[model samples]
Target: MTGTRLVIDGVTLTAGAYRLVEDVSLAARPGEVIGLVGPNGSGKSSLLRAVYRVLRPVTGRVSVDGTDAWSLPVRQLARTVAAVVQESGAEFDLSVREVVAMGRTPHKRLLDGDTPEDAALITSALAAVDATDLAHRPFDQLSGGERQRVLIARALAQQPSLLVLDEPTNHLDIRHQLEVLGALRRLPATVMVALHDLNLAAYYCDRLYVLRDGKVTAAGPPADVLTPQLLDEVYGVMGEVTIHPRTGAPQVTFLPAEPHPAAPTGAEHSSS
Candidate 1:
């Protein structure tokens, strides 16, 4: 297989005194697309950070290809894993091509420059994200969505066996969102992405793990995990889930929450 196997077993993450994820266990086979879906403050990002080596778990282990991730050297880990996180820093002063080319750093000596092979990968990555036109432009001048696409291209250039992305569709138009995700779906890498869009996740992911309040609420295939009852319980909203006839993916239609009963009029509270 071309991709890496990821095993996150009995992992618990905490921030000082606060627990962000509690006893979470998940695994992704080579070349599978795994979705992490949950509401805000539901520990999805925290879990991702742990996988990408930003946060060390308080308990349990994260292993890639049977090796403990924490025990690997940073450069070795970077070669195997690439992450596109939400909190990307300030605008770079470099050109878009330069930023994307940075992905080659892990494989090169400090004095080494871009070889023809590196150039090809850079061009291919840009094309993969539909960002080839923006390559010559300065990265600082691009809009949010453009920068996001460029970041994704950078990750693609790394050619990691496992790719982790947090809301890669954010700031993208509908067309580009589909393009980016479709490109990811075709890659020979194991992908773990956290998404707020249920329909998109259902369409792209081979399996899903639902998080809520630092715990896993559910885990399974879309058809098995995304029932109306699960949606209501986990998201606290009424929703209808159906299979799309053509796509065969679950589609969710959310309805407004029921209103609470009104209090009695002022006259009913008056004392005689």
Candidate 2:
């Protein structure tokens, strides 16, 4: 009953005069991992902002469990939804554990100190993200991958019903990328993640939505959404799609486009 169902109804996202995503309707059922995949500048992040209540849609609303998310108080909204954004900065010189502990804020009263239960949750979250060693490290001192994991740990500590993340695998090594996505896959919360990696999306997401020119051009199970024609048309990249032998998920392998004749090769350019 704690898990949330998300409904985005005809959301038209915009920035100043630019229309990012228009009339877009999307849903994430409880315990579903829904992915948003698109090339850069394709409104993936923009759409997520609306779901997290950071960006108000031009003409529509986002609902969590059938209640308007934008109408809720900020603290109440935070209790139901947790977001791990791409640009989580460490301006304050806090420890990694301290940063993760901030996730418990919504659940505590104004003057409540950390309880034993809170401490236990924090410890468990750090361990889940493999950030136990960095718990005492200064937040600003960690590397990009380290910060990403720590931020994810912080979000996990929130224990929210809905989780929203943008590019959760950026800067991570292949192993950690798999680790992070795998963790997301195992969570009971409704997950909405934006990813550039098609193969990862295919592996982790229950459903995939392909965004292009600020619109969702295709949506379905990965096997149906990630076809060669769709990849070529939406991404302008030639790709081969096949079933992964182990997981039976769709696997995408990008092919090199035909080289432009006018573009010089390294040797030709050096001779010139």
Give per-residue CA lDDT, model 1, range 157-187, as digits (tens). 9999999999999999999999999999999
What does candidate 2 score in Cα RMSD to the true structure?
Answer: 3.6
For residues 197-264, write the lDDT of model 2, one tens digit per residue. 99999999999988888888999999999999998899888989999999999999888887546766
TM-score, candidate 1, is: 0.94
Candidate 1: which pairs clash?
none
Please list the Cα RMSD from the true structure of every candidate, rounded to 1 decimal place: 5.9, 3.6
Give candidate 2 regions above 4 Å deviation.
259-272
The 10-residue segment of model 2 with minimum total lDDT is: 256-265
Colliding pairs, model 2? none
Which stretches of model 1 miss by more than 4 angstroms? 258-272
